[model samples]
Structure formats: structure tokens, C-alpha cells
Target: MAPVPLTVPRRALDIVVALALLVLLSPLLLFLTVLVRTTSGRPTVFRQQRMGEGAREFTLYKFRTMRPDATGPGLTSGSDPRVTGTGRLLRRFALDELPQLFNVLRGDMTLVGPRPEPAELARRFPPEYQWMFRHRPGLTGPCQLHSRSHAALLNGMPDPEEYYLSVMVPRRAAMNAELLAHITLTTVVRYLARTLWYLLSAAWDRSGGSSGRPGGDATRRTEEGRSLCVRS
Candidate 1:
């Protein structure tokens, strides 16, 4: 299948859905903002430069999830001490990413597509992944689905930054290219639904506080390790 063009209809669909979600989720967004401010101190939002379509740079927004004084490489590990208490909760269900709805509204992103890479990472990507730059970055995508969450991916890694750069980036880029090639309305809806399911599952786990999922983290880490090894 050929890659889906960024047609007028697709853009319109993004705008309408993004606007509706922003309106519907406004209360939760406001509450999260206040919570982040009170818990993490001022500067509730974290904005970083990310590469988008045609390698354009744009400010990607998320609820601040790390301490202001924390200093380290850009990559975050499962045991990173910089992640705050509230930040952990926010990240568990990916609530920190809610701010990107505004980006979608502003036309910097889509609800489903290749997740945007940081500017530095984008500059280092191989030519095989260059096709991703032709499309608007997305809040969720095939790469995001296939890969483990940040905690799982970085678990027990000797060097999280190096592991991510050397192993994860290229794998995700290839998946993103594959997703872009066969992208359709049905594919987009499937990806969105899967993302929502994961979010809900994470929320349930958080609420239950480890009812029956013993050793879940270890199992996930093992799976992630195997996945990475397979590609290696």
C-alpha cells in the first residue's frame, strides 16, 4: 500500500477531533495543570524543540515531569532520580502529554502518526528514516506501540542514553516508516484505540495499587530485553 497523503480531508479530521477533545478534556487539563504547579513548583509546562514535518522545529509541550535542578543527559532511565513523585504519576498514564493537544490544534501534530523526535536525534537519524519528516508528527504511532514504555525500556540499562540511541531509535524509525506507508483511516483508528486501552490499563493499575499483577515489571523488562535483542 502507498503512503497516505496529507490530504485536506485528513487535516480537517485532525482539526475537528483535536478541537473537540480539547473542549471535552478542558477540566482535566486544568486540574492537572494546577496539580503540576503545586507538586513540581512553578513552570508547570515543559517545552522542548522537536523536529516535525520537513524537519521543521517546533516547541513540544508537556507537563513538567522532572525537577528543575536535575541535571543530566536528555535521556531518562527507569531509576532516574530526577523524576518527581507527581511526575511518576503523570507519566504512568502518559497524562503529561495532554498539553500536546494544543499542538495538534495549532497544526504542529496529528492524533496519529510518527511520534516526533528531538531536534538533535532527528539530525542524527539515517536516511532510511528521512521519509518520516514528510508527515506531521503524531501524539501516538506504530513505533510507540511496539516499543516499551520509558521505564521498561531503560530498566537495568548500563547507559540509558547510549542504549536508546544505539538500539531503540533506529528500530522505532523503521516502524514509523512502515506505519506511514500503509496508513489509512482504519489503521489510524486502530492505533488510537490501542493507545486509549493502554492509558486506561495504566490508570487501573495505578488505582488498584498492585492487586494481582505481581512481578509485572520484571516480566515487562524481560520482554523488552528480548525485543531489543531480536532487532540487534
Candidate 2:
């Protein structure tokens, strides 16, 4: 086999963690799947083609957060009218992304790396940024940790897709390249830890658990995750 950027140990870790998470998160996944079905009416899981390792394409899954018939631009802000109420909650904390754990199990992705581009948008990605296809796209990574910030920027855009390709994509490409350049066991571990914290914090906030104060514990934890993304 060709030597992929993902090392043997990293792949081992990915498999172990992915399996454990699938087993542990199964109940929550079931609940969410049912919730989406009941709330949005069938097709609980959304499937889309995404660009992956070596520029290969594969189906990525997410717990559906939009109406079964909703159709519009792929890039969505929190305010996208197509998003259902359940989906708004799901998107706020990224609960919609939980299904990608299966993608990790199936070797379509790793727990960490650059976020994948939509297959259709892959061509729009600048040729210079094409290097991102080297490794399997990650379930989460450095650039991905800044998703909320990017989404906020996107929310106000006259054209989310244009701003994404022209603005966010360059930043994402740079962050992805930098992280890959210095990838190490320590780097991977840090990313995984930060991701865990991010998920937990986001979930809490979305669940109406956020502290209502500026410098409260919840905000502090979120801020810490933001800082760690810069230096972790």
C-alpha cells in the first residue's frame, strides 16, 4: 500500500476510538435519529459526497437537520431558513456531524485532519489548495475548530459560497497545511482532547446549560478551547 500521511499508530488509534465512541454514543445517535425523523419527517440521515483521501470521493453522513424537501445552496448559515428547528439546535452545536463517526469507522475519514470539501465544491477549491487531498479528510481539525467563527462570517455574507471559497478556503488551507507540517503524536492527542472539550461545551450551550454571564465557567471553558486552538 502507498504510505498515506496517516501513520500506523494513528490509524490504530482512530479505529479504537471510533469503535469505542460508536458503542458509547449509540443511544444518543438513536435518539437523535428518531428525533429528526419525528420532527422533520423521515430521512433521518443526510448523505452527501465529499472529497477525501487522494482526492477520492465518498458519502458523508449527518443526522438530517433540514426538511426532507428543502433545497438551496449547500453552504448554510445558522439562519438558513431551510434548517428546521431541530436542525437549528443540531447545527448550533454540530450535533448533526455525529454520524461521521461511522465514516471514521469505515476509513473514509480520520478523527483528525483537514475538513473535507464537498465533492461538487472540490473543483472550486483553488488549484494551489489541492494539496489538502493528500490525507483522508478529518472529522475535526485545526481549521474545523474555528467553524463557528467562519459561520458567523458566513451568516452576514451577501454570498456565503463566494466568501467561503475566496476567504475562508484560503484560511482553512493555510491552517490545514500548517497543522500537517507539524503533525506529531502530541499534536494528534491535543487535537482530540480539544475536540472532546469543544463538543462537550457546544452541547452544553445548545442544551440551555450555558452560564448566562460573560466570564462564567461555561464561557471560560469555551474561551480556553479557542485559545488552545491557537497554541495547542
Candidate 3:
């Protein structure tokens, strides 16, 4: 696939909105920083190497939601022992990802694009899927939203990287390509609205005392020998 020409106007808008959001959310960011420090102890921010556009590597940021030494293989499960009580709350409310607004501001990410993958995981993707690398990774994208409720269940299982590479990546790539095909102000607004809705809905569910499913039956089926191939 040929690289899509990025629109300067849209990129400028993304930058402006990201910077504004960082400024507006400064107080909340500070509070979360203190909470993480008090709960997880030091290193309020978590940084990890993630594969970016054109297969370049970049450091991604997030609010620390695990013990300082929680690093290992694969993704995080909801029941992971490394997650602190505060961390669970942050994850539930998606507060753990707030720090990525900096990523958006820094040009390392976008408000909407394919979610970045760890370098090791990216290595497992086939060459065709690597086409996703043509665009900047995003803070909130199709795959992130799609997999939001299943992280814990998926992370706990063996070879979960297959789920991300085989299932999530293709779906995300399609959605991202669609987004690029129709990249416009209206689409961006709609994407922003959907992202906000998901966040607010998650917050409401948490406040209403709901235990969101760790994994859906469909996800289980995919894990249980079902093909993860995406239809063209």
C-alpha cells in the first residue's frame, strides 16, 4: 500500500487539541501523579518502547498502574497481581492512559489511529499487517476500544500475543485505513465523541458497581481455536 499523504491542517488541529487538553487536564494529571506515587511508590509515569509509524521505535507514556518492576512478556491481565488497588481503579476509569495526551502533544501519537504495539509484538505481525506502521500510533483507536474490556482475560492466557496480532491488529488496521480514507474534520469530531462516550460509559459502569466482563464469549471463541483472520 502506498503511504497516504497526511493533511497538514488535520495534523495542526491534532496538535492544538492535544496541547489544550494537556493544559486543561493538568490538575487531574497532578492528582493522579500523587495517587500513583502514594500507591505504587515512585515513578508515577510508566514509559515503554513502542513501535511507531514507518516501523520506527518510540517511547510511549502512561500513568503508572503497576509496581515499578511489573515488566515481563505479553499484555496486562485484569487479575494481574502487579496492579495496585489504585491502579485497578485507574485502569477501570481509563485514567491510567491520561498521560498519553503528552504523546499526542509530542507528535509521537495521534488522538485517533491504530494503537501502538510493543516492539516484540510488532515483530510477530506479518509483513502485510506491518502496513499499519504507515501512520502514527494513537492514544485511542479502534483496537484499544474494542479490546478495552478483555485485557485481563486475554493477558492471563497463553500466547495472548496471537490475539493482538491476528485479531486486533487487522481489525484496527482496517478501521484505521478507513479513517485515513475519510480523514476530515467531521470524522475526527465523531471519533472524539465516540472515545469520550466510551470513557464516560466506563466511568458510569464503575460507579454503578458493575464488574465489566473480563472477556466476552466471542473473544473466548477466538482464543479457542477459531481463526483470527480478518475479511477483506
Per-candidate count of clashing residue pairs (backbone under 3 Å): 0, 0, 1
Off by over 4 Å in 2: 1-3, 203-232
The stretch of ten residues in a row with the least summed lDDT in candidate 2 is 211-220
lDDT digits (tens) for residues 90-146 of candidate 1? 767777788888898888888788877766666766676666777788888876554
How accurate locally is residue 209 in candidate 3, as Cα lDDT from 0 to 100? 18
Compared with the true structure, all predictions reach lDDT values of: 0.67, 0.70, 0.65
Q: Write the per-residue lDDT of candidate 3 for residues 59-155, one digit (tens) a residue.
A: 7776666555554335665555656688778877678778778878777887877777766667778888788877787777666675555564464
Top lDDT hit = 2
- Candidate 3 error regions (>4 Å): 1-5, 152-156, 206-232
Task: Tell me the deviation in Å of residue 87 in model 1.
Answer: 0.6
Query: Model 2, residue 163: what's the lDDT?
Result: 76
Sorting all predicted structures by lDDT, with the top scorer first, yields 2, 1, 3
219 Cα displacement, candidate 2 (Å): 33
Model 2 TM-score on a 0 to 1 scale: 0.84
Q: Where does candidate 1 stray beyond 4 Å? A: 1-5, 204-232
TM-score of candidate 3 against the unseen true structure: 0.81
Q: What is the lDDT of residue 102 in candidate 1?
A: 86
